[model samples]
Structures are given as C-alpha cells and as structure tokens.
Target chain A: MDVKTRKITGQVIFVLLALYLDGLMKWAFLNNMNTGEVMLIPQLMLMVLVMLSMRISDRRQLITYGIVFGLIYDSYYFGMIGLYTVLLPLAMVGVDHYKFLFVKANMGYEISIYFLALTFMQSGIYILERLLQQTKVDTMDFITFTLGPTLLWNMIVFFILYIPLANLSDWLVKYRRDK
Target chain B: MQKFFSNKKLIILMLIIIVTFGLLAVSVNIKDKKSTPPVIQQVGNDTVSIVGGIFAYPTNAVKNASSEFSDLYNTYTENRRLKSKIGELAQNQAKLKVVQEENKKLKDELKLNATLTDYTFVNASVLSRSPSSWQSYLTINRGQTSGLKKNMPVMSGKGLIGRIIEVNKISSKVELISTDNELNDKFASEIQSDNKNVTGIVSKYDSDSGDLVMENVTSTKDVKKGQKVITSGLGGLTPRGLYIGKVSAIKKDNYGMTNSVYITPAAELRNFTVVTVIKSSVSGEE
Candidate 1:
C-alpha cells in the first residue's frame, strides 16, 4: 500500500495497543480487589488518542476514530454503550480544537492537555453513572478514593511513557507533512 | 428558525448531549432487563474476546509463573501443615465414597432424579477485568456456547468468587461478589453449625474492611465466628453447598436495628486467572 495508508494503519494499531494495555494493566497490576479503597484506572487509550489528535489535523478523522474505538472499548471493557461512545469523541474534538494554540506539540503542552481530557472524561462518567443510579458512591468518597489515585497513577505513567509515545505518534503523522 | 439553524456548532453540541444520555439510559436498561445482550453486540464482544484471549493467555502464564515463585517461598510451612491432614483426608475420602454410593442407591429407590447439590461446571479462563470502579466484572472465555447461563455461581480454586451477569455467544462476564451494587450481588447462604443452620442473604459488600455483609438473617443467636458459610440453594439459579466463606465477625447496622454477619471470603479474588461456572442440574424458575 501507499505510505499514507501504511501510516494510518500504524496509528490505528498504536491506539489499539494502548486500548488493550488499559485493561491488561488493570488486571495485572492495579487489581486491588480486597485490600484498598483507592482505585487507579489506566487511561492509556485516551493518552494515545490525545497524542494522535494533536498530530492529525483532520477534524472528521479525529471524531471517527473516537467513536469507533470508543464503541469497541465500551462494549468489550465496560459492557455499556454510551459512556466512552460520547465522551471520547468530545474529548478528541476538544483536543483538536485547542491544538492550534501551541506552535509545536511539546511534552508540557501535550501532558497538560491529556490531564485536562482525562479529568473531563472521568468526571463525565461519574456524573452520568450517578444519574443512572449505576453507582451510589458519594462525591467526596469518589473524589478522594477513585479520582485522586487515578490521576496520580496515570500522570506518572504518562511521564514515563512520554518519549516513546510522542515519537511514535509523530512518525505516524509525518506522511501528511511530507506530502 | 433561521437564526437557530445557522449555528451548526450549537446544534451538534445539543445533539451529542441528547444522544449521550439516550444511549446510556437505554443500554443500562437493556443490560438489567435482558438475559442476553443484542445479537450484534454478542458478536462484537465474542470477536473482541477471541482476540483478547491471545494476549490474555501470555499474561496469565507470566502471572502463574510469578505466583509459583511466591508459592515456593511458603512451600515449607504449607507442606508441614498439609502433611498432618493427609491421613485424615484419606480416611474422609473413603467414608465419603461409601456415603455417596449409599445416597445414590437411596435416591434411585425413591425415584429422585436430581437434587440441589448436583451441579456440572464449565471452566473458563478470565480474559480481562473491567477497570471501572462500580462494575467489578471479569470477562471469561466460556459463554452460551458452553451452556453457561446468567446468575450461575462462579468459583475459583478455593471457593465462590462471583456470578455470571452477562453471556455472549462465545464469551461472558462474571460480576464479582465484592461489587456493592444493590441489584446483582445477593447470594442465599447459611452458616453450617452442628445443631441448627442460620440462613441469610449474603447481600452487601463492606468495602471498608473487605468483608461480605450478610443480612436478613433468621437468628444471630446460633451464629458464631469460625463457622462455615455455604449457599443454601433456597434461591434459584445457584446450587447448594457451594463454599462461600468463614464467619469473621458479627456487627449491627448503623441504625442498630438488626445484626449483620460479616464473612471473610475464601476466594483470593485477585490471584486466579481461571473460574468455574457451575450449572445446576435442576434448573429453577426462569
């Protein structure tokens, strides 16, 4: 195939890897079933999606990726439909909208954007689940136990994985720049 | 109308919000009300799970190897403790064999076909556990194709772990017993004592201390710590004599109106990668 098609395929595979890694990481390491109140949800897929959105300039492409992958994510992992299906596209669009403010996608800007996106998506989920009566956790307990630990853990992971992920996403989007 | 139609971004934003809540509400209801999800969803889940098994198997292997290393660390003490019980276990096995034979003969004479304790199991390796906080579900490889059904009790190496909440064509989801959800976590259980059995619903999970809280108990007077707890089979779907846990402590609710028996679950909940889905021989009311 052509270079552009190959590059797009690489991007999809990269995001898919991140998606699987989210569930596997939770199952392997963060499986705190019995002992602790603190919960850490791995959002590696969001991290990859944000990185790709910053690089790929097309708005429609971003939304499409968001919806398709989000549907798969929700169906396979969450066993529910709309949480990721809606929030993911919104988060991607939000990233794409603000991306032009930065001249170059550096670590600082990308990490901050990811942090914002993660916060928005997670809080959106909590609010929606609360409204649906799916979860009864009060606001204070959710903030302290689930949200706090999740942010800290994911931030550390983003920091550790920043260099490779940034370089990979840059390579995946470089074909458009060459054209 | 013209002014409102001119703002495309606003229209899209409103559409997204409306669709979001609409999809969430409908799917949640379907999940609660339906025995199986829609066929298209089942196909999607089965495809994802099949691919997931490729990744899950290797991770499970690594997990098993690591756990084996830890097991080696405790081998000496475990061996010593187990050695003393070997003789007793052998004698119990012989006695149990004779009793089972006599019981089978008696049942045949009485024309009884199946009992609550009769169950068959399908073993499934867990593919992944949901990262969500409230939904503590594990996706397993076996599903409707394996004759698995919803609400069937799941067990690990030690004891009961959870129940099947959703079944797809080739994969299913097991909702763990530790989930605090009000609708799905209840298991009818009874404390086994020498004289009298105290029956109760193993309903709530106390996340603070990681203990299962049993409520609606008939009497706490006969309940005692260190007693065994098992499924009483009073409820439909689950079979009798499935090991639940040991009675850890008894406490009163905040209102102090009733007593709750707390059980320390026998299943490790974190360590195992495979689960057994028990199919009761005598199906209860649908």
Candidate 2:
C-alpha cells in the first residue's frame, strides 16, 4: 500500500484495538462485580478518538470517524444506535473546533480535552438513555456512582497511557515525507 | 420562504435534531417489539462480533488463567468443604435423576410435549461486555442460528445471570439481571419456605448492597435469611426452577404497605467466560 494508505490503515487498526480494549477492560476488570454500586466504564475508545480528533485537522474525517465508530460501538455494545452515533460526532467536532486554540498539543491540553470529551459523551449518553427510559438511575446516583468513578479511573488510565497513545496518534495522523 | 430556507446551518441543525430523536425512538421501539434488529444492523453487529472474537478469545484465556490461579489459592479449604458435601451431592444427584425420569414418564403418559418448566440450554462464550453505564449487556457468540431468542434467560456456572435482549444473526446481547433498567430485569421468582411457596417478582437490583430486590411477595414473614429463591415459571419466556439467589433480607416499602425481599444473587456476576442461554421447549405468549 501507498504511504498515505498505510498511515490511514494504521490509524484505523489502532482505533479498532482501542475499541476492543474498552469492552475487554470492562469485562475483565472494571465490571464492578464486587462493588456493584460504583461503576467504572473504560473510555479508551473515546480517549483515542479525542486524541485523533485533535490531531486530524480535517473536520469531515473526524466526523466520519466519530459516526462510523460510534455506530459500531452502539450496535455491538450498547444495542442502541443514536447514543454514540450522534454524540460521538458532536464530541469530535467540539474537540476539533477548540483544538485550534492550542498552537501545539501538550499533555495538559490533551488530558483536559479528553476529560471534557469523556464527560460530554458520558453525560450525553446518560441523559438520552434516561429520556428513553432505558435506565432508572436517578441523577444524584448516576453522578456519584457512575460518572464520578468512570471519570477518575479513565483519567488515571489516560495519564498513564498518554505518552504512548499521543505519540502513536501523532504518527498515525502525520503526513508522509514523500507526499 | 426561499430566504428562510437558505440558512444552511439552521436547516442542518433542525435536521440533526429531527434525525436524532427519530433514530432513537425507532431503534428503541424496534428493540422492544421486534424479535431482531433491522437487517443492516444485524449484519453490522455480526461482522463486528466476528472481528471481536479475535480479541475476546485471548482476553478470556487470560481471565480463565487468572481465575484458576485464584482458585488454586483457596483449593485446600475449598477441597475440605467440597469433600464434606460430596456424599450428599452424589445422593442428591441419584435422587434427582430418578425424579427426572419419573417426571418424564408421567409427562409422556399425559402426552404433554412441553411445559413452562421444560428448557434446553446452549452454551456461548463471552465475547465482550458493554462499556456503557446503563446498558449492561454482554455479547455472546451464539445467536439466532443457535436457536437463541430474545428475552431468553441466561445463566452462568453458578446460577441465573441475565436474559438475551437482542439477537442478531450470529451474535446476541444479554442484558444482565443487575441492570438498572426496569422493563428488562423482572423475573417471576418464588421462595420455597416450609408449608408454602411464596411467590414474588425479582424486579429491581440494589446496586448499593449487591442484592436483587424481589417485590410483591405474598408474605415476607416466611422468607428467612437463607431461603433459596428460584424462578416460578409464571412468565412464559423463562422456565421454572432456575436458581436465582438466597433471600438476604426483607424490607418494607416506605409506605409499609408492601414488602421487598433482598436476595443475594447466586451467580458471582463476574469471573465467568462462558454463559448458557436457556431456550424453553414450550413457546409462550410470545
């Protein structure tokens, strides 16, 4: 394959791996089985998406990644289409829109961006599911139990995986020297 | 009218809102009412699950190894406890087999093909679980091709775990019993107490204490702390005698009018890499 094709392929594979890791991590570790009250959902896919959104300057590509992966995620995992399919694109676009403020991406900015994206995506999902009558968890309970723990856990994971993830995402989005 | 329609962003925003609600409403309706999702969605899910198996297998292998390691740690005590129960277990097994044979003969004499309690199971390996907060679903490898149907109760090695909520071509989603969703978790359950069978619905999950909330019990007076709870088969989709859990505690509603039995679920709800989907022999009101 050509260099551009190779880069795009690498990016797709990385995102796919992240997506799979999200589910595996939940199944293997963060299932909240022992402590049923506090739920910690791994947002590795969202973290990778946020990183890519910041790096990939093309708005249309970011939105496409959002909607497509969102659909796959919703279909395969959530069993609902609209939750991720719409909100993911919105999150990506939001990241892409605000990323211009940062002349150069740094750990601080990337981490905060991921944090915001995670919060927005998760809260959006909660609200939509609530309205759809998919979940009966009250607001306070949701925030304290689900949102609080998920954010903390994912943030810690993001911090730990930041260097490698950021570098990998940078390489995936960077243009070829030959081009 | 032309000028009003010329605002591209406004039109796009309106379209997006309409599409969002429209998609959400339609998908939810289809999931609740239909046996399977749309063809496109089924194909998408099946394809994704096919690829997901590659990652799931290795992870599940590692999970199994870890669980085995933990089991090894407790083997000495567990072996002693198990040895004490072995004689009783063998006796119960022989008695159960004889009773099952008798029940089969009686059913044959009556020409009863199937009943609410008659069920067969298909084992499916764990693929992956949903990472969402509300929709606590587990994707298993088996699907409609394996006679899996929507709302069929699933079990882990220990006991009842959940039910199949969505069935695709070659994959399906099991909504666990512990989910906060009201419509999906209700199971017709009963407790076997001395002299009587008190029936109730396992309708809610208490996440705080990790107990299932069984409501509408005839009498909480007879429900002891250690009484075993099982499915009553009142609901046609689920078969009778599926072990749910033990009665942990009984609590009254705020009004003191009704009682809810808190059950400690039998299934660990984790550490299992495979699940069994119970397909009832008798077709109910579905």
Candidate 3:
C-alpha cells in the first residue's frame, strides 16, 4: 500500500474505532446512570489520539478522517446527539489551518492546545447546553476532580506518544514522496 | 527544516481549513432550540426536544437501519418483537406523565421543608470523611465557584451525615454528626421522643448491646425495654421521630446524673454518594 492510500484506509479504521469505544461504553452509561448524572466526562483520550494520528498524513486527510470518525463517535455515545460530528471536524480544521503557522507548537504549545481543545469542546458545549436550559452544566468540583485527571492523563500520553509518532510520520511522508 | 512547507496542495488545504473555521465560528452562534427544523431560522427549532433528550431518534434509526439490508440480512425477527415492546413503552410513558404531576403535589403538601434554603446547592461527590469522633467531618466535590459557602450543610438520604463547616467550589469539608459526642446526646432525646411510649434524656449508647439506661426514671414512668429509640429532634437539625435505635435497658443511675445509657445510631455509614442540597425553596419555581 502506498503511504497516501494506506493513510486513507487508516482514517476509515479510525471511524470504526471511535464507534466501538464511544458506543458500547455509552450504552453502559445510559442504562445504568440516572438523568442529569454525567457518566463520561469528555476527556482528551480520543481527541489526542486523532490529532496525533495526523502526524502520519496531511491536512485534507486529517479532517477527512476526523469527520468520518467523529460522525460515528457522536452517533454512538453522546447525549448531545450531533456534537462530536460538529466538534471533531472543527478540531481537524483548526489543526489543518494552524499546524504550519504554529509549526508543531513545541511540546508545551502542543500539550496546551490539546488540553485547551478538550476542555473547551467538553465544557464549552456543556455551558452552552446549560444556558440553553437543555442539560444541567456542573462546574463545581468537576473542573478539578474530573477535568484535572483527564488533562493530566492526556499530557502523559502525549509525552510518551509524540516523538515516536512524529518520527514515524516524517519517515512515511519522506518514503511516500520518494516512491 | 520544514520541507513540507513547499507543498502547494498543503497550502491550499490550509487556506480552505482557515476559511471554513471562520465561517463555522460565526455559524456556531448556538441558541437553545428544542425540536426545531434545520432550515435557517427553521433549522434551530424543529428538533430541539428530540435532540435534547435521550437520543431517541438515533435508537429508532438503529432499529430501522438494522432491518434494512444491503446484502446480508442484518436485523432478525427479534427486531419486530422489540419494536412492539418499544411501542408499548411509549404508550406507558404518556400515562406516567400524569402520575408524576400528582406525586409532586404530595411532596409539597408533606411540607418536607429543611432549614438551609437560601443557597445554591451544587451536587458533588463525597471524597472522604473523618475517622474519629461522632462529630466527624466529610469532604464534598464542589468548592468556591460552586457557591458552596463556608458552614454549608452536607446532606444525603433522609437526614444522613451533615453539617458543613468548610467549603470551596472544587472541594468542601463537612462536620458529620457522628464525629461529635455533643450532638449525639441532643439527637438521642429527639430519637426517643418520636416513638413515644418511652422516656429518656438525649443520650448516646451502644446499639449492639442489650442494655440502655434511662435518666430521671420514675418506676411510675414505666419506661420498658425493647421500646424504640428515635431522634428527639431537640437538636433542631433533623425533625423528631426519626428512628435512632431500640432501647434495651432500664437500669437506674447511682448519682442520679443518669446511667451509662446505650443507644444505637440509625445509619451504617459506609458507601453513600449523591445527596440532596436542602436549600430553601424559592416561591415560584416548584
């Protein structure tokens, strides 16, 4: 498989992955938890995973994967209904637009964006939903108890992940151009 | 250093992303729309309710989609069975709406009012509690931003461990009634009053032991064993008549100060989360 085409296929796999991970656990959350109770606080888990995967490819492709992947993710797990589809595509577009001007963003910038992105995506929609009188937005201990761990965990994963993935992506991009 | 910058296709793609994000930023002026349609002003209002609640449309779509087969038969006859069950459930839901309205009225009439009513009670998790003293403290998950003022009461169940002494939005500490012996004595008198048919001072005694002593005992008062010991409600926290424990003794005191009265606590403090914030109800939005 040529690198470009293989990367395309990987995006499709990403969609399926988002579906399985978000869907089954969502089923559990829905069946067991009560109304107004938050089961899965939005985390950086999938967001970082998708963003990191982009190192292996290009901007157009990143969104192509993210949108396809996001549609499935939103469909399965969230009560917001269409949010993931909306948010994931936007995140991809954000990265594609700024990835170069920002230029890898260093380690701190990357992690900060990653953290800010997840927090804004999760809490932004939640605050909006709460204001609209849809779902109640809980900002109490959630900022610390819940948001802190998710960010910390994602940062740890990113540190472990970025260098290897960046190298791999560089290798693949070079190899594809040579071929 | 940046070899990828020379790629024209990448530059064009970045331009497209930048423009699209700008458009979306403007378009994302999301107002709350319930059951609204998706065309201009029409789009925001058509399906908000359906969108708000339990993604019912999606599940329905799943059922219909499963029955639809491009090649192999995906959904089985069991789908039909489940579909009918879903139909029955929908009918039942309409009936439930009426019952819920009726129940709300009853709660109001019961006058189940608590003392702390003038504050916003943020629902938070119980992180930890003190290990010693009946006047023990608990920690909650909310703090400063949550409007959890200091000395706010922590509560759960029908009057579980409460009495908030410290608070922040992200975390708060609570002084549980179990951690202090002073409140326990006051609570005992209240517990004993609820059941009536028995007499005793507000006191603390062992629950498991069979003997509970009574102060100011007149053999004529006829305080008998095995009588129920409940909250006397004199402490002004929980109301009178709440069950605390059963009386197991009728022994007299030597100094007339009272005997070593043994009384059991009502609740077994272990794994409880999700408490009600008993703030005073504002008059219009019941």
Candidate 4:
C-alpha cells in the first residue's frame, strides 16, 4: 500500500528476475542450447549485480535464496548438491563477517568481500575436491581456467546489481520519512 | 568449584548430542538413494543421447529483461513473414516440428551408433572455468551414470580437456591434458601422439604450452610439426582418433629419434559447452 513496501517489492522482483536470468545463462552456456547466444551481460556479472542489490534481513532468508538458486540449477542438466550446502552458507558467513568492517570503510570494500566470499565458496570446494582425490583435475591447469574469472564474474554481477538497489534503498528511505 | 562441575556436565551433554546427531546424519545419508554415485563415469559415455531423454525437451523456464528490447523487432517483419503467408506458414511450421523431432531421433541414433564405435562420447556440460591462473578444473554435469570411467578421455572441439578421473552420481572431474601436479604416477607415463599415432609414455605435461612429452621411439621417426597426435590403438585402453593436439613445434635430439614437441588443442580450454568422451570399443581390436 505504501511506497516503501512497493520499493521493497520491486527490489525483490529485480533480484529474482536477475537470478532467473543467471539460471537461463547457465542453461544456455553450459547446456549449449540453440537459444541465440547474445548476452548483454554475462551471468556472473549479473550474479554480482543481483548480490549487490540484495539486502536480506536475516540468515534464514539468505539460506532460502541460496537453496532456491541451487535447486533451479539441479533440476536442469546438473545435480551438484555439495555446492549448495557448502557454498551458500559460506557466502553468507563471509558477508556477515566482513560487512561490519567494510560498511564503515567504503562500498568497495563491501563489494570486494562479497566477491572474495563467492569466489572462495565456489573455487574452494573445487580445490577441496581436487586435493582430496575427489576430482581428476590436473591441479594447475584447473586453477588457471576455473577460478579467476568466476570470482571476477561474481564480483561484476554484484557491482551491476548495486546501482538500481541503491536507488531503491533511497526511495525506501524517502517513503519511511514521508510516512 | 560449582562452576567447574556445571562446565563438565555441559561438555558431556554437548558430546552426547554431537554423537547422537552425527549418527543420525550418517544413517540418513546412507539411506538416501540419490547419494550413491552413478556408474559409467568411463564406459557409458555412449549413452549421452539416450540419457539426455528428459533434458532435451524445450523449456521457456525464464524470460529476461532483454526480451522487451527484442520484442518490438519480433512483432513486425518476423511475424509478418509467417502471418501473411498462411499456407506456407502452416506447411513450414509442420515441417519445422517434424524436423525437430527428427533431429532428436538422430541424436538418439548417435547414442546407439556410439556403442558401436570405440570412441564413446560423454556429452557433459562445463560447470566452471575461471581466468584466474591458479584455479584449474572443470566440473561436468555428467558423472558416473554416463558410463564415464576414471581415465576416460574428455575433449572439447579443440582437443583433450582431460580424463574423467573422479566421478560422482551426477558430476565428474576432468583432468585436462595439460595438468600439473598429478597425484598418481602409474597412469602418468603414457602419451599417445595425436599426429603420428605413435604411443609413448609421458615425459610430463609441459605447463608452459600445455602439451605432453611423448617418449619411446627409436632414432628415426619423423615426428614433425602440424602432424596430428592421437591415442595409439596399440595400448588399446583409449579409443583411437581422439585429437591430443596439433604438433606446433619440435626439437630433434639429433642422436636419437625423439623430439620435444609442442601441441595445441582446437578448443579454448577455459570455455566450452559440450565435449565428447572417448572410450575403447567393447568389440575390441579392429
């Protein structure tokens, strides 16, 4: 009914929509479908954008979003449950751990922390899998190809997502004041 | 003294809870059917098309913001072509659906035809590859159930991504042809030339260019550049005709019949959608 609520709803819709796009990109890129591969922004970039837009209230919601993201992946051609359970909470933990220091320092710090956490959450599991003889990767080559850009991509996604979310946050503040 | 007693009691309580929950968790994990690893991480790559039965269906699961930008173009000439020519439209649409069905049928045919060939391709998706120099590994969507075996070869359009060295029910890890720090030495000593069909044990995966070091030739084989290197049918473990790489450069020993050769793949290792898995044919020794 109020502008603040409407703003919050819009933000949620944007994040969800971005997530859906990332899921589609995963399908398009990974599955090699015939879906005309013209990406305005790559999925990882979009992911970072969405993450930047995100300002969840509590840990439970963060976990819920993570599960939803993971399940969307699983239902498709992939089924990596280990990634979701391990990576999602770790992302949240890293974010929470760093949020306090970064928030005071600058948005850049906050963003970097998000990037590092997501990167670690993803590639860390990969590293573990390879090290424990759980994977068949030729350790160095795997490092060269799989870790770096994935980290940067997530960071980019967060960066892009932050812009619109900032405007929405401003609006929410305005509405709260007016009320 | 009283506080110490309470702390001791608390520790005992925590330990009991941990053990109880740990046992429960283990039992639950054991009970779940999905938790088990799928077989065929190596041998069943021939079944990708068969196994792709459900996954190949078309889906409009997620629409994106960019659609609004493109919707205007679709509404005009795109629709007019199909709309004005109704008779042609009907025929073409019917034909198009038929063609699609046919295409899927052909894919199934490939799957069937696959088993007949020594080269069994396990079509798996690239899960992750980053530009970071250190993070080298690709997670594939297909795992054990796909007939992927440990040491089963994987390649993109360019050439060898690696072998399916580790496998779970739904995913597999490929050890790319140019991997460093191999944990196992036994399988490490073999490199089948993509060019000459000469079989030699590996000197090592040269990281500088990401090629293999092939050994065991006399002082007379003409191992030259642009020559194709592939698995030798002699070893009979991996199917032949798999591209190891194009021989980029070579340095002759002068006294012996060996050269330090550089080979490059056809596919960019960091990015690719699909890849084939090469397996030795069940029929054996042609």
lDDT of 1 by residue, A73-104 (tens): 98988788999999999999999988889998
For each candidate in the order shown, give its overall lDDT on alpha carbons: 0.92, 0.90, 0.44, 0.49
lDDT of 3 by residue, A118-164 (tens): 77666655554344343322577456544665467556766887776
DockQ of 3: 0.07
Model 4 CA RMSD to the hidden true structure, in angstroms: 12.8
lDDT of 3 by residue, B15-106 (tens): 75565445334333321122211233222212222232233334434533543442235356767768889988988998888886676676
Write the residue-wise lDDT of candidate 2 on A63-110 in tens digits.
889899989998889877898999999999999888889999999999
Q: Between candidates 2 and 4, name the one with more favorable lDDT.
A: 2
Candidate 2, residue B264: how far the Cα is off, in Å: 1.0
Per-residue alpha-carbon lDDT of model 2 for B112-231, expressed as tens digits? 999878889999999999998878899999998998989999999999999999999999999998887767779999998987999999998877798999999998777799999999
| Total clashes in model 3, counting residue pairs 3 or more apart in sequence or in different chains | 47
Error of 3 at A147 (Å): 2.6
Give the Cα error of residue A48 in candidate 2, in Å.
1.1
Order candidates by DockQ, high to low: 1, 2, 4, 3
> Among these predicted structures, which one has the highest lDDT?
1
Q: What is the interface root-mean-square deviation of candidate 3?
A: 17.3
The candidate maximizing TM-score is 1
